[model samples]
Target: MSESANDTAQPVTDWEGYSFDTRQVHAGEYPDRNTGLRVPPIAMSAGYVFDDFDDQVDRFAGRSIDPIYSRQGNPTNAVAEERLASLEGGTGSVAVSSGQAAISSALFALAQHGDHIVSTASIYGGTRILFGRSFKRFGIEFDYVWDADDDAEWERAIRPTTKAIFTETIPNPRNDVTDLRRIAEIAARYNLPVVVDNTVGTPALIRPFEHGADIVVHSTTKFLTGHGAAVGGAVVDGGRFDWAAAERAGRAYPLITAAPRPGLGSMLDRFGTGAYARAVREAVVNDIGPSLSPFNGFLLHQGMETLSLRMERHVDSSLSIAAWLEQQPEVESVDYAGLPSNALHGLALRDYDGRTGSVFGVAVRGGIDGARAFVNGLRVFSRMTGIGDTRSMVIHPLSSTHATFPQEINDRLGITPGLLRLSIGLEAVDDLKRDLRAGLDRVAALATPAVSLAG
Candidate 1:
């Protein structure tokens, strides 16, 4: 029998203490009291029942079970949040409308207008833009370090005003692994929270909190949904970092440290021990209005059921495809942890379950024109901008995803003009190989000289 979400039931683990496969299926689920249903049902009502004014008062005062508004919290979203948090070993989680919102809200929750943040150079392009353009406009400054793995670089960049160090577990396109343990040591010395976006690896492959990450964010819009049908994001609070320590150190986080406006309680007081995630919920998300809709939450819930199973297949197929692509004469290199030639292979072996994710890039011999020709000629793989779908996705990073970056930054990150990033999927490996072969053949066909008029 399963326990309720509110029940402090001790989690059960396997011989190795809770296998990743088991946790994916059972972590946040509970036996329903009303129906005794094994799976928690979606609560679609916009608001929950409030017995009286006293009940409402109690809930608003942080003393009750009554969830008043969907904006504040929904049963469906709470269930999904709880399950995901359990997977990451976080004390709590907050769901948002999209991945970008998760980042936006978390940053706001951590720092104030004048405070600074230090981040890795190569991350999701949109995140880079958010830090470079938008955050600067709002008076929040950011410093970018070339590699998160370089402890010396990280130490050198840290300043008194620095509030956080942000990076992805496995960076986009490049497939570089940030050495979490090493960076976390640096963050610890400076008393800064290390926030990591674990979207690419997902919880099945890596849990940054275990490696000393204070907070973890996810674009559940990706592998968490698996099918590419939903758009949502989540922020997991490891509850490991002591925000109280920062307060004791005499710094105030607007969301967590300061007293709430007149009537409302300070975020930490209202939310109790899970204040970090709750701050993102009640303050950043509420003010910004990026709540995940109930229907999308339901779609993500459906996707979560088979996450473990799908990830295994996704990893296996990706490894096979990457290995094959590396051998092709037209392909210059493959960036994936599963491949021995990959620069991050050793890191992946130690940190990942010896399994890297499906997203990686291949540099073609002919540069931009050849990449375009190859992608346009392909029939089986979709030339789409998104990733982590059930079907394979292919895109040229230089002309598409990372096109906005300066050439020097692109060169530094290895997003070359000829690079084609592939998000391998559940399709039969042979079929994918044949399609890739056809694409290369098309490039070859275009390069061949036409028969002479004399012939």
Candidate 2:
């Protein structure tokens, strides 16, 4: 698991090509000066003190960079945002309330009434619903590339109103590896900026910007925080997309290029290279009120300090458990991409240098009934909807995460009744295997039950 060169970051400073571990510990942060505290303290203020009336005017007028209200920004949250931005190789970032808010804000900032987005059919069920239900109600439309590997599909679905291309770095459960470079290539022809959900493939595993992603987002509740304690999200701008140029070339992104009002300039005109990020912060996050609390930001930053270590163990344990499960007689199949037999193994190797992500699907020999027994048999693994937690968790998607979806949609997503999504955690590999084996043993018993039905 640790053989790959890309899996481990080189030991160096952030500027001198810092390793992943180094950045995790020191990126976008430094010791305090006023009190000279080694570990920085969280700023718990609701608002900052204005120097005077002129200072207030300057802040409101965009002349001052100092924070105004906690609803808009906070010092502690700012550190987390910058830390994530640096780790993801982004020029700027804005932390939001949750991963959902991050995705919502980014989408809303990029489009409005009558605009559209091109996305992969494979996405988080929550995001699929958000795009299908909430965003649709906003008068915006969505066009999904059911098969993103096909270049023609992406090209065909993109309309002039298509404002952005969305995809996940590593789609959950299915473990389907997205050809990020391929999708970015397809989006480039249309002058579209690719927005990648990097929650699964956090920067420690694979840096999407290195593969041409224009924007990166994270559900800090997941691996970025390395624990399930904090619920937060962030949007990171690569600052590589030329919004003004795209609009000039007829691939218009009105949210960026169009003037906000009759006289005022557009985001692109105001912020230059940081147009998208600025809009996400000022127009969407600020106005819509999905602000991340400073306390949560401090927690997220602390979690990031151990991100590299957690990711390393998570990958190793996941590979171990997946391999052991494949050998079990009660196991039908495992959808882990790290295994050589899986279809996306090569892609994962190339993208991550050998670390397949921790989340994947496991299908027991029995169907939904078998799934129920399997989950019921587990002792150490917690059955929950969240992923990337320090404690291992299990979720039955057909009845949990995607239970509300129609049968056809579930089938389309390959979410069979027997499939149980396992988020492998930081537990000992052998212990995890034993726990799974115990479930498999019960799975066989479930099939041959002693039902005393006296008719």
What TM-score would every model get versus the actual structure?
Answer: 0.92, 0.93
Off by over 4 Å in 2: 1-16, 258-266, 449-455
RMSD of each: 3.8, 6.4
Q: What residue pairs are clashing in model 1?
A: 14-18
lDDT of 1 by residue, 52-168 (tens): 889988887656745668877887787788778878888899999999988988899988788899998879888998898889998899999996667788778887788898989
Model 2 Cα shift for residue 417 (angstroms): 0.6
Off by over 4 Å in 1: 1-18, 32-38, 149-152, 261-273
Writing each residue's lDDT as its tens digit, candidate 2 over 1-455 gives 45687776553324437766777777767557688776668989989899999999877775566878888888788778878888888888999999999998888877889989998988888888888899989998998888877867877899888889999988988888788999988888888889999999899888889999999988999998877988999999999998877878777767777777765678787777677888788778879999998888999999999988889999988888888888888999998888988888999889987687899999987799889889998998998889999999999988877888889888998999899999999988888888888888889997786989999
Error of 2 at 436 (Å): 0.8
Per-prediction backbone clash count:
1, 0
Q: What residue pairs are clashing in model 2?
A: none
Q: After superposition, how far is residue 250 of candidate 1 from its true place, in Å?
A: 5.1
lDDT for every model? 0.83, 0.86
